[model samples]
Target: MHGPEIVTTLLEMADDGQTRPTPSDAWHLFLSGLRQRFRLPSGRPLAVIAAVLIASIVGGFGAAAGSWAAERTFADLPSQARVEALTRQASPGDDYSYDRSTSAWGTDTTMGALTVSDWDPASARDRFAADGWQVTTVRDMSAGALAYTNDPATGSMTPLPVRGSQFDAVRDGVFLRVTGYVSPGHGTVSVMLWPDDTAAMLPLMLAGAVLGLVAGWMLAAAGAYRMRPLPAGRRRVATVLTGLAVTALALPAFAFYVNMTRVLGPSGSFVNTVHSALNASPYWSYSTPRMLLLLTVTGAVLAGAAWATMGRRGRSTPAADQIPTTG
Candidate 1:
């Protein structure tokens, strides 16, 4: 059309407020158009949301299952059996430490015999005998020292001199027979944490798992929204990377893991070996397995969402049909 024809047409369309928009108007219209297009599908987004809810439920259940499994798996693991009550925390004005590798509940070591502190061995043994306790077996690791191993064949006796009033003062003053590995300084004190029912701790693990699920959902939602839907292969890569990132950050979520390692070591310790690292950290009720449930489920859900949003890049979608087609 000629310049005048076009100008006249523009003026007429403008008078009625129906003119073809300029480039700046077009840019705004395009942005607005995208908002309308990406508005999640009605029933579809709900289905996705429902799927996430199901995932959370599964997560909670899964945590309980994992706890059950760990309980069973680690039950027969080399353990310490302690029947002694905690006399006090870090005993006031007294410094006593047993080397975990060198000490044991039932077995006496040369290290202990050599470092006889605070009491006389001859007197302790003599006192024990006077209390009507028949000494079953005494092994002399060296001179002037003896470790007596009592047998159950003997009747439940009263008390020994070495035990002192402090040991005998407790209401639960019955002596116990314990069996476990001997660590250096832990001695009789470290052998007590064994054979605790793992199932008792399951509920706590499951709670952590539940919390993990919520965190997973948020992470997945945020990541899925941030990533521009890509081609199929790229989408998979993105999801995997996102899942890994989530997994890597998991350790920082708890100060306990740090503290646990500092104090507990490979198998963990019965004593307060890790006092320095301990902190007043809030722990999730079922944090452990719950977090696993969250991360896995969330990552999986995000993967699916990423897949749905990232169809063939060059392809068209039915949802996009409502937009005006241009030649």
Candidate 2:
């Protein structure tokens, strides 16, 4: 119908008592308004968006995979049982107390102090050496300590002794160190045991990242293709939500990997020991479980939106058809 005739017909329908609007009418009108407002990108712009979305997915998955691999590498380290056993042993004439615990990030720490009468540094060194430990003095440990936590002036525990004499050794990939504070006739010795698997973990983490990148790329490509049929407005919203969810999912992985790197080596000018690194900042700032829950909720919402709008074919009306036409 022509414009005037169409308007008159609509006015006549509005005057009829039976022409009342239904709930469905309001809903369809709302959706129609949204479709007009949020135009979909076509051609090159759409392709570019798909590419960016795919990249985000791939990167997030890569980092997550690497972090998981790194954790496995740590857990696979030699003999936790043996390490725990050695960590609990104390020499005769020494009053010892120790505590052992594991962190959320999968680090095992054994720390304790020993009170001994007649503090003899040589005897202490020899005793550890006899246990097949290549013991070294605190001075040597300070010099050879990991650059990540070596601060001589601050007297931090990067394998350094606070007072008197300190000795440490590395065996079976475990760190064994003793810090002694001696007085007139006796002394208090602090002992710490830690596992060092950095040399084995980094390469595995890199490999995992590579694998995840490939997997994410494939998945993103398929997902983008599936979303092609959705309306521009819905597609864009879904894409943004998916991107953010992927980012949230991957955050802990990358953060963990970075923290591990810092713990193992120097992070710019900032230094960190494994204990201090895991227990401080970023890692301690938020809950991993909560971030994961967010990812799950976001995914569900995206899926529900898609199911509602994408139809049985999981496709929307063609982008070309949605474009306005004027004569």
lDDT of the candidates, in the order given: 0.35, 0.52
Score residue 15 of candidate 2 by CA lDDT.
Answer: 43
Candidate 2 C-alpha lDDT tens digits along 128-151: 788888777653223332223446
Question: With candidate 2 superimposed using the best TM-score fit, by how many Å does residue 197's alpha carbon deviate from the native?
Answer: 2.4
* Reference-based TM-score of each model: 0.24, 0.54
lDDT, candidate 2, equals 0.52
Q: In TM-score terms, which candidate is top? A: 2
lDDT of 2 at 316: 30
Query: For residues 174-247, what per-residue lDDT tens digits would candidate 1 score against the true structure?
Result: 22111212122222211122232333343444454675465545544444443444556775676565455334
